[model samples]
Target: MAKILKSTDLECFQQQGYVRIPEAFSPVDALAMQDFIWDKLEEKCSILRSEPNTWDKHVTGLNKSAENTIYSDIASQRMCRAIDDLLGEGTWEIPKKWGSFLVSFPQKLNHNWTVPTNHCNGIPWHWDG
Candidate 1:
């Protein structure tokens, strides 16, 4: 099979510690993921996707649904191939399901955004750790 990630993608990963693979999954799959997340948000956090005013938090986690197939839907073979390209075939085991994904919601309030000069300054912007 043809490589899903190119040489430049590998180089970028080497230099920047990450890479982007476009269309790794279909739009339908993405929508499904979004719907699942929104449902979780409403169920756990009382945040409704239909109401923009309720988007209070920048990050909300959905951790409990680890065995759902929605994860597998988003984890397309293209994405797996990209991973294999980077890490080598059979080097890593892809989880059947994912636990604890954070959805970064856009704040309804407006504010000036700037790049953080230091680690401590970047507290507002963080990963799903």
Candidate 2:
């Protein structure tokens, strides 16, 4: 969380249809995630973190780990404010924990199978209210 979201940022998101918030997450906290990922990789396979050459095959699935140890300090208050501005005040709901994670592999799978597509056409869009 840094500066407040100005009208310019909202305008850019409306015109360009996207906004990039650099360094939203803490780099120092995120750096530790490398070790957590490596530890999980080692549990499934014999590939060591030091030996990158051994990590040739890509994993199709992964074991679920506690969000506390895996994704610490990932929430960005700056991002939340920006989203709130776009969606309306108090519209964005901060969850108690991480949810709805769908990690697509580098290899191609199904074409249509994915998260809900929002082309902003006649799609059924509404709030939980």
**Winning model by lDDT:** 1
What's model 1's overall lDDT? 0.77
Q: Write the per-residue lDDT of candidate 1 for residues 8-78, one digit (tens) a residue.
A: 98998887778988998999998888888888888888889889788886554466775777888756798
Residue 65 in candidate 2 has what lDDT? Answer: 58
Poorly placed runs, candidate 1 (over 4 Å) = 108-114, 120-129
Clashes of each: 0, 0
C-alpha TM-scores of all predictions: 0.77, 0.52
Q: Considering only N, C-alpha and C atoms within 3 Å, which residue pairs clash in candidate 1?
A: none
- Superposition error at 94 for model 1 (Å): 1.8
